[model samples]
Target: MELDRHGLLSLYKTMTTIRHFEERGIPETGQRGMSASVHSSAGQEAVPTGMCANLSDDDYIGSTHRGHGHCIAKGVDPKLMMAELFGRATGPNKGKGGSMHISDMSKGMLGTNGVVGASIPLAVGAALTAKVKKNGKVAVAFFGDGASSQGVLHESMNLASIWKLPVIFLCENNGYAMSTPSEYGVSTTHVSDRAQGYDMPGINVDGMDVFAVYDASAQAVARARAGEGPTLIEAQTYRYYGHTVFDNPLTYRSQEEEDHWRARDPLKQFRDVVIPQGDITAEELDRLDAEAEALMEEAVKFADESPLPAPVELYDDVYVDYPVDMMKRGVNMSV
Candidate 1:
């Protein structure tokens, strides 16, 4: 489906933001060795940007370790995320949680999980809450191919289908599970094929193409909202980095394989294919790229300037030694 000018630009900007956020730790930011927490979503920007576009602030999303892109797409402030990675008190979780645990309940971002397939059950729980409350809200689990192997994900899918919960199991099959490629681990040819085991619809989309992902996710979201239970979407995308910042991808995958995926970069695809087809011009798109860079630079600066959490506030979000003392900490506590 074709998108309007505003929609196209909005998707572009979101993808650009994710790309930059992930790239900040690369040589482009001149701090390649500075942070180990940053997980590169370098090429997988379209999945979250497109899928989250179909969700509202009330609609929840549970993410994974490589979740900066997901949080940014869901309306969390990039500056705060950067600060969290920098271990600053101004972070979403007061810098304590950092990259793996960025949670902003006000924005309906349940939390970014470090554990594989953990988001599935968490999002299912949120959907159950929504169903019980009759809130008419949907919950989404943005997981990966690696997490697809986890038993909890299968259990969550079965439970959601049995109860007709309003949840979408959005999987980002980014070709590899860390250094181990997906082909060696996953039994099914496509992750979505397992959706049938739970008696729900399964869709496989070109995760590299933003518009395709957007359209597919929109339909699945509409189905969930209409009380049609859940749908599993396996977005076939690729990540242009190792499992984490410390990983060297060249050790496992060949440079040619990496080069092949990099050539079909989502941002490049949007700029080249969508821009000429949509109302916006290449110049306008470039302008947006420059703007995104400026915003990320500001975000980095904000993160760097943020203060570190104090030792005294260690129990800020935890069960404290005393209730009255915790009360003294106030209701608007950090995190």
Candidate 2:
């Protein structure tokens, strides 16, 4: 699976964009005094970048709390996403779903789940829909090392295997599940190893290396599209920031450990691998980086300028068919 020059640049662009989005958006949360804390996915850009590169707008994906990268990779507009974080009416969910709950059904992003392992079944259900419709589309479930132990993950894997659903169970094992390290939590050395129990192919890839992730995901996606069962992919990645905006990782992990992972930064790794190939130059990558920065600037401006949701419309979108008047009428009634 040789990627063309365009494909290589696309991968670089997506990763850079995600990096910039997180770097810029995290600060906005603070400046705006947002109540909801953002879970930054700064260093784990490669996992979503590589996996979503293999998917189309019609394909589905379920994301975790740290899922802005997933949304960006899956073709959701960053401007809309930023607006959502700002709680603006122009947001994808009309300011209802904040940072952790950002979603765009049109882009096949089911929604980022606040619950640890909840998104696993959402992707599986989407896979079953694709299977029933014979749409040839696949779904990817993006979770973390902590969620790997959740029962929903195991149950979803088993169901997908039995039904031969076109889904990929992607576990972004970033060493720790919030504060709990993988060593103290997971029984297996690698989360993918558990896939054997469900009779699916289990793969462990260097999540920091975009090319490695791309290759593994491409194969898994191909297998799923061909009617094969689900594949469990454990990406050994790391998050540069704490689990959420406020939690300091230094409490549980050492600076030396964080520094070690930071040394092999995914963006730098991409440059190291691609620049020498002679197809993409340093100037080109710099230009892409500048473009990503500019895009985030515009996203922030768009979000900041967008109006807040109107208070009277609070009942709007609560139900698909319910009248707003009916909901307002019942608002003051006791149960």
Best prediction by lDDT: 2
Clashing pairs in 2: none
TM-score quality measure for candidate 2 = 0.97
1-335: candidate 1 lDDT, tens digit per residue: 66677888899999998888878734433362335655788899999999988888999999998898899899999888888877789988997787888889988998998888888899999999999999999999999999999999999999999999999999999999887788898999999999989999999999999988999999999999999999999999998988877788899989999889989999899988865665788888898899889988998888778787887677566763666465656667554
List TM-score per model, in order. Answer: 0.93, 0.97
Q: Which segments of candidate 1 are over 4 A away from where they belong? A: 25-35, 320-335
lDDT of 1: 0.88
Look at candidate 1 and tell me the lDDT of residue 25.
Answer: 33
lDDT of 2 by residue, 188-306 (tens): 98999999999999999999999999999999999999998799999999999998888889999999999999999999999998999898999999999999999999999999999
lDDT of 1 at 278: 55
RMSD of 2: 1.8
- Per-residue error at 191 for model 2, in Å? 0.4
RMSD in Å for all candidates = 4.0, 1.8
